[model samples]
Target: MTDSDVTISMFERIGGSATIDRLVDRFYDRMDTLPEAKMIRAMHADDLGLIRDVLKRYLTEWTGGPRLYTPEKGHPRLRQRHFGFAIGDAERDAWLLCMRGAMEETVTDGAARQDLNKAISGLADWMRNRT
Candidate 1:
């Protein structure tokens, strides 16, 4: 089957907003504490609350639940937003490491986990702003 055919909406696979919140929380938690995440973690503000909310809303719309982020923030423009940061291979890998841990803790379905991992990996790679 094609990837789209096998793909489930991130909302359904992740159990909606509550689960997304948990996932984001766990992701930030790891970023805050993990030694490997130090470089990427330093890029974020001391207060992660707003960032968490933004991510939660963005993921909600991305997964087909609601368009909350777009309505408030306009287009995602993910790459553009990340351009101000010095995202290289190390930073990208650190972000992915945190996200992978979060996904492992939040998603139980093997297929869903793989799908999310693939998408996240691609996004992380795309976020790399430096050579």
Candidate 2:
């Protein structure tokens, strides 16, 4: 196929497993330490290990690398799963703050980073359950 005919998944564009891992790690690191993320951080377990792995797999699958998430977790009904949390605009912003910082630190490609940021920002917005 010609170069223009080739379609690269966002996963590949962002450097696959390694980048996803770093992104998730950085995201949680920010949540674990940032003052602004305190409310949302409180919703998570003190031990971030399990969620970290889950995010890695979810991001991997979401970005089109491999079916690392759904094969085990089924379709990511992310909003439904998060319904118990009191997610509001502030919570969404806090999440975006962490995710944006993580994307900046981990994702090297500018275009890919921007795309991921937009998509993830949408997701964070979507997760809001409160007005």
Candidate 3:
């Protein structure tokens, strides 16, 4: 199959919200535990429940599922939202490391994992507020 055929919506490819839930859950769990992710994890609050929901909703809309984020949070001005944080190369790389580990633990399909990684890389790069 061509790339287009292989390119399923992040929702369908990930088995819907259930899979997303698992992915996000495992992601936070890893972030909470991994040494390499310590810096990024420190940025977040002690409570990860709300953040997890936000991520799920945001990803839901982002992956061509539903427009939950836009409706609830308005436009996703990700860079603006992240501007308060010091997102230098180190921070960005750390975030990517955490996300990559999460993806590996959660995603099973090769194409879907690659697509999510590419999109995440772009988003992480965009979230950079510093060098």
Best by TM-score: 2
Q: Model 2, 4: alpha-carbon shift in Å?
A: 1.0
TM-score of each prediction: 0.92, 0.97, 0.90
Which parts of model 3 are misplaced by more than 4 Å? 1-7
Q: Residue 82 deviation, candidate 1, in Å? A: 1.1
| Per-candidate count of clashing residue pairs (backbone under 3 Å) | 0, 0, 0
lDDT tens string, model 2, 10-124? Answer: 9999999999999999999999999999999999998999999999999999999889999999999999999999999999999999999999999999999999999998888
How are the candidates ranked when ordered by lDDT, highest leading? 2, 1, 3
Question: Using lDDT as the measure, which candidate wins?
Answer: 2
Tell me the tens digit of each residue's lDDT in model 3 across 30-127: 88998988989999999999999999899888887878789889988888887778998888898888788888988888888998899989988888
Residue 130 lDDT in model 2? Answer: 94
Query: How far off is model 2, as Cα RMSD?
Result: 0.7
Tens-digit lDDT track for model 1 on 26-73? Answer: 999999999999998999999999999999999888877778899999
